[model samples]
Target chain A: MSDTSRTPTEVDDAALIERARREPEAFAEVFRRHAPEIQRYVTRRLGADPAEDVVADTFLAAFRQRERYDLSRSSARPWLYGIATNLIARHKRIEVHQLRVLERTGTDPVSDPFTERSDERLSARSVRQRLAAALASLPAGHRDALLLVAWGGLSYQEAAQALGVRIGTVRSRVNRARNKMRKELGGVDPTSSISEVHVRG
Target chain B: MDEMTQLDRLRSEIPTPELSGAAERRLLAEIATSSQPRPARRQRRRVNLGLGLASGLAAAVTMGVVITNGDSGDPGQTPTVQPYSMAAVTLQRAADNTSKQEELHPKPGQFLVFESQTMDPVDSNNENGHSRFLSRSKRTVWLPVDGSSLDGVLFMEVLPPKPYPGWPLPPEAKQEVGTRGPDRLADFDQRAEYLRTDYAYLSSLPTDTAGMRKHLYLELEPGARADYEAWDRVGSMLAEGYLPAAQRAALFRAAATIPGVETVKKSEDAAGREGVAVAMVSTEAGERQEYIFDLKTYQYLGQRTVVVDADKAEAPVGSVLTATALLKVSVADSAPVVNGG
Candidate 1:
């Protein structure tokens, strides 16, 4: 995070946001920097159709609220993610339904377009289905915390910031979500199953 | 094998999709539009005045006594005519012509769309200190029939700007030329009730000349300034507000009675349409505010503000401060949705 935040060619998101208040076109830089990451996060939760709209609204809402941004936060990742998470909460039904569909049918509507290799699909199917069931069964807050840490690649503190919760709350939710996933997988080592498929491949 | 690892692999194949062109355009458009400073509350009244300076052009002219012609020394010469009589004759003709035009009957849930072109002075204070230029735009506003300005939607295309007569064109002026919004028309509206131009309120206004005249003067303190305010109200109504023909006729007839109104033989709208105009001088501002009407049809063409006193307006006499052409008004079933939420 420190290294990415200090990339030589990059301007601090805080500086861009500050300049945007005076020169609004400067906001396009902030959008160009973060939109792809935010779009993928949204697409993973909801499907592609709604991701475009959600991402657009997230940046627009952030632009409107830019004046209130805290300049002390040099990186805008947590702030942008926070807005995207709130917007994703609006599509909770879609997220849960997609997860349940993947668990029951062994086909991921959210990822179908990107799964190019049949061998990769075959190897990951059982484990993927179990993971989907575990995810769908978790409470919304627990699910958000877990995904922010695992899929979003946010640290524990970053997940708490993104979710607007205390670090302690994020820690507990992730722990509880992990325990639920282990139970759903029947306490068996899924790696051994994957290793057998790997050898066959 | 762990839950976090399994979760990480879930939907992990989904690549970060590129931002679609349409979405990027929408964001860029919004940013470009929002960069233009919103008109302050007081400036909004000037916009409502339809003079186009409502964004930031300060009303610097001071209010002064109307200089009525006092000389009657030349009895042999044609009797000096009061400005009001000529203005009254033109307005009455407009009233008669308006009564015959087809009227729009917008329902409560519909929108009254107003499309117009405007050029007004924009004042910017930044690292360069104070600089001024003429900002021009083509705008379409969708105002809800029953709600305040807060419920309206605005779409504007910024045109290349011109220099504000003696002032150089500010560099920032060129940076904002492009399309913006189907966004909210206003952040908030704190207008007095009588000033509302919502179709619902306009439709309910008194449709008789006497009552309409009273409506224009509502809450105004009596004086030459009050008369100017009443005349200004007429400009506001004609600028963006739609009225049923009967009320429109009454408004025209009422406007004709404002104390200092005089008919200007020649005037041109922002779109360059030539017409006869009825004008009133704001003695304080040293400018003449004119509302042009088609010569034969008597239809309202547009409104403009021209400097009449060079020293007071701080511009050369005859220099135009603001001009607007209201191009079209129609009823729409809905406004365009830009938020995508």
Candidate 2:
């Protein structure tokens, strides 16, 4: 059977588990690697304090439950993501309420205008407002799944795994969320070239 | 403030703080002393802690088994006990908002009761006696039949098991209780269900005046690591009942500022504890909402959770909330006594 011999990117999750079982300190290594990314993800969603709590909760929970890990998969992002997803669920009202307030008041907890070079992007508050409003209007599940894929850049399967749902569910949630967002954005078409510029890296 | 621009601007202004040194030390120290025994190694170590995030569920499973095995027995087995401080949980409701007077006036014999049900027997007395441990997903109320004077808060603390009492737990239930340190039962995830029940049942219990200090106290089951600092803001608002009408609105405004919440309803509790029932939903799906009843006319007694969600989120398809149910009782009725120990 294939073991831990795979490429670094392809290292199976089982290998990580096998190693963690032997070395307890190996758990901290996991946190060291993922903490930054997880921090970034959480910061993007819930701001600083709550994000910190969420990150801590995520890692602590992961550390506590490390023993039952299945080693079939290579990457642990999904598992970590799954735990984070659950934590995020616990704070949905704050997130939703914050988002709704932001939508109506045009407030962004972390939005910055100075860093961006594009004048069009900078000036397009109305467009961004519509987008934020649309995003807030979508139901909780859709928003989370879509953002995980879009912002966190997790793959469909990985996103689903993180969310503790099937891959098909992730796809549909994203699709539905996207559709609703598009409708709310005054028919702003995301598929077109102009929209492409807005989303470009 | 123009919210869109403000958000964008704020995002740029603040750099996310790196993991705090104090926090890291605290967390690492917790790991060092954790009661969870490492599983025996079958192979040479091939993985590093870099893989920490992925092992959460597995860790959860293992810890659950370990803690369960380690602690399992009759909850009443332990005889030695430590002294615990009795804490109170309170919620303000709609009637309390408007009346600015008494919400409940207790008659004779009926007093407010609060309880914190535990898997570990609180003491030999409670363990062996008539104390009841409400299940993780069930909550109910038993009001006094004799029109007893119903006043004050009734809080309950029902907590998941720990490896030892009043200390760090193994990793499994740590996140549920917020940290490795000892916590009251009211702060657990299961408290959400019980909180809802407390709100519903608080209506049935009588209040003192028409609207004096109107509020319900949902005492987190003992061992809950509640966000007390944050919840305290809500408490202060409920406490200041004598404030003028315009000032009272400020209290509500203060509460609205709390993050991640939705106002669910405004009505009288079963006991006629008139108040606003606010529901705070979690951003992530399947998390339980915290329902708060800010009551009028009743003193902020304590609160308790009668029930909590017991199944996996997916097990109950299309259901955002699990099958957790809750009920609240008066503290006078539920508080445990040690039989003159």
The TM-score of candidate 2's chain A against the true chain A comes to 0.79
Predictions in order: lDDT? 0.72, 0.39
Candidate 2 lDDT over B60-116, as tens digits, reads 111111112222222222112111110111223433354564334433344433221
Off by over 4 Å in 2: A1-14, A110-123, A187-201, B1-24, B36-341
TM-score of chain B of each: 0.78, 0.27
TM-scores of the models, in the order given: 0.52, 0.41
lDDT tens digits, residues A1-201, model 1? 453646778778899999988777688888988899989988989888668767876786678668878887877887788777777775788888998888887778888877776456533666777788888999989998988888778888888877778999999999999999888887445766555433321
All candidates: CA RMSD in angstroms? 23.0, 18.9
Report the Cα lDDT for residue B336, model 2: 28
Cα lDDT tens digits for candidate 1, B93-129: 9999987777899998999998887766665533243
Which of the numbered candidates is closest to the native, going by highest lDDT? Answer: 1
Going through the candidates in order, their DockQ values are 0.21, 0.04
**Model 2 per-residue lDDT tens digits across residues A1-201:** 222434667535556556756654556666765676787777666666567667766666666567766676656777787777667765676666666665566555533322344333432444455666766677778877987886666888889877767899999998887666556655443324243433422
> Model 1: which docking level applies?
incorrect
